[model samples]
Target chain A: MRFYESKTAPASKGDLTPMIDMTFQLIAFFMLLVNFTDAEQDQRVRLPESILAVPPDEPYEERLTIQLASKDVIIFAGSEFSSLDQLSRALLVEKQILEAREKKVSDTTIIIRADRESKTGKVQEIIQACQTLEFLKFALRGKQAEVRVRSPSN
Target chain B: MRIRHAGREDTTELQMTPMIDIVFQLLVFFVMTFRIALPEGDFSIQMPSASASATLEPQTSPTLQVRLKARADGELTSITLDGTSMSDFTDLQQRIRRIVRDSAGPGESGSDREVEIDCDYHLKYDYVIQAITAISGYVDPETRTPHKLIERIRFAPLQK
Candidate 1:
């Protein structure tokens, strides 16, 4: 096998402008990607509204939101979990992070934004997962004062 | 940042290799995590919570238990407010309002009667929300505020 040497070829400068541009673009992309983590939530679930439901004014010290959708789908922080074990395991990791940060595990509130049509059992299951992790604080999400039609009269 | 070739070479070239490698890694990370369309959950919503064994304040007021029974297909079969069965959500709403009125009668300080929602495991959440709506009266759309029948509401713990 003959290997051609480029020693005789004219020394040329490959433009680094594109690489720099692409890198900047990527950095910007990931920066925006992470800044907007809320974009990954499943939108199919319609939230229930309550007159008493108030929007939180204070930022969470540390928070995790769980979205429960129809057909038994449980999504945590943008990843889907099919079983309670998976959900618990993932929650344990979050618990450890809080622990390492010198924060109390129970202080980490798990926000549940379940679809209005989702099974209560499923929502309960997610709560149980948080409870198992010793994270007792919870925030259940509902829209504020939504006008909904009453159930059909029999 | 560019490095100068030591003594003889006059050319100054930008250090592209390392920067390019790092950029690719970042691009890959962002691409892997990019989700094209996830629209909702933009604004946060807050809900009131109650513990299973939480005792009622102003103990004279009864804790209303709204039980929802469902068929195998997830259709709501019955909604009983404290064992009195009702046909639909409106009936449940009326009964709940009446109970609230009685508990916190006029010419008296409103009673903070607690409500516990106990739902069948297989029931669709639509009905549960409906029951919640029934118990939680809507705002007069024009007024944007409606008095709640029961101020303290919580989920009933499953019977183990």
Candidate 2:
């Protein structure tokens, strides 16, 4: 007696479509999270201290940084202004320019980095100048003081 | 029937290219808006802490202001009261006591006389505390009585 055998064809395809879709999603997630620093910025000022201080952990875009050095007030995006009046004008111009180009200005903020040893009068002047230009929001930069431990000699 | 069988095994593909592009765009937007804040220095003063301290009432006019400058030799070289220079610490102490005493009434509290102390940044911590102690009621070592003269001492940073 002879036995009859049946032959079956194997599945031809393994799908890579799901993997490609997942890879694309991952790429998108990282792309949305990356923050880019503006090139025309300057941040070289000593900050004041407090009893409770935390390091800043924000992304760097959409900020206008103002750096106050020993003698001059430097605008990060534009030219340095020697006086508060000049800085005010430059701020106004920049604000208008940004609004005109972007058609929106709600998210922009100003950052003031003044040296810790600088006078309060100067810092107030800068604040007043910014207020006049309608740049009401500001972030004051400051460093966390280092803690020291005392060892007792018995 | 033949056409229906041919369509049964058809596979549909979803393109993720546009979704990926939009996600990258949002990431770039957030990254561009990130701000790194620099430190601000001036007027960041470490005030000496006191548990028994009370806040002062607002002054209608400028109170008596005393400016104390500490020299490199660890001595208070100059003392100015309300823009007028005083010759010695004794004189400064006397002036403060007189102002506080004159301001207080018989039944009124001594908190009205506010003394503002403008200290130099380079001054030693001990010197600052000493100045504060002096401005407030000084305790006579011999009599051991705390004279309730000056009511409050305000610490102001020196203006550059």
Candidate 3:
């Protein structure tokens, strides 16, 4: 009888309000800090560092991002092209799309995210491909370095 | 009557299971999608097509050419600014500063000064960027402000 009485007693419930409040705070914190602009950054290319590589005051009106993963591979719009001929064809399609929208092809900035180890000639070739398409503005992207590159007088 | 009061109080207890489940799911979703991005910047340059460049009239100031020599293994060997050999990128920056200071009088901007980067075929792209960084500008260590050196930058024809 004693065992039955002890087993039938109501269980204790501690306060859950504080835990719920803390979890809600954590959720709010994470929601405020989440970013979705990292889609353009690829893991294959490690950009060269430059102290003078400061973000532009105003973002370009229209921009196309092209990444060079290796000497033989170029990534544009998540598609890989091995040769300049293929890349040129892709760029032509993009130009046609821009023209269809009544947009000036020259106004679109080409952002080159070439690997630090890639060949310079390959980058120039990429530029030549864009040039052939009448895209004039080129923005060479680089990782920001914190080191001080002071002037000679200093 | 006492048992009825106790049952009424039990019925008033909050239902927290569903709310907690949804909150945890949201937290997990955010945690899974969180990404830390490194700050990046650009060096903007405008280059016209070869045919267009040929038709354009020559400027009053000559385009200063900086040549980068590289080894078979794709390492930078030497830097030359307008046919004058430079020991390193720092030296190149000094020479450019002197030229800009002398050419541009008081309150004149360096926009008219142009620089052309001529890189070897097999050179690593990083060295070319280093050259561009040195030619474009320098950051003041004291104020962390970037001072512009040359605004106009163009790449030379690719060397075979």
Q: For each candidate, report its DockQ versus the true two-chain complex.
A: 0.23, 0.09, 0.67
Comparing 1 and 3 by TM-score, which wins? Answer: 3
| Winner on lDDT (2 vs 3) | 3
What tens-digit string does per-residue lDDT give for candidate 2 at B13-58? 8766686677566656655665654332211122222321335345
Chain B TM-scores per candidate, in order, are 0.56, 0.52, 0.84
For each of the candidates, what fraction of the native contacts does it recover? 0.29, 0.07, 0.86
Lowest-scoring 10 consecutive residues by lDDT in candidate 2 chain A? A47-56
Any idea what lDDT model 2 has? 0.55
Write down the worst ten-residue block by lDDT for model 3 chain B: B102-111
- Pull out the clashing pairs in model 3: none
lDDT of 1 at B98: 78
Pairs clashing within candidate 1 = none
The 10 consecutive residues of candidate 2 chain B with the worst lDDT sum are B40-49
i-RMSD values for every candidate model: 6.6, 12.3, 1.9
Better of 1 and 3 by lDDT: 3
Q: Which stretches of candidate 1 lie over 4 Å from their true place?
A: A1-37, A44-54, A57-59, A143-154, B1-60, B102-111
Output the better candidate (1/2) by DockQ. 1
Across residues A36-101, which tens digit of lDDT does each residue of candidate 3 receive? Answer: 765888888999999978788998888899999865589998799899898998999999999999
TM-score of each: 0.62, 0.37, 0.88
Report the number of clashing residue pairs per model.
0, 20, 0
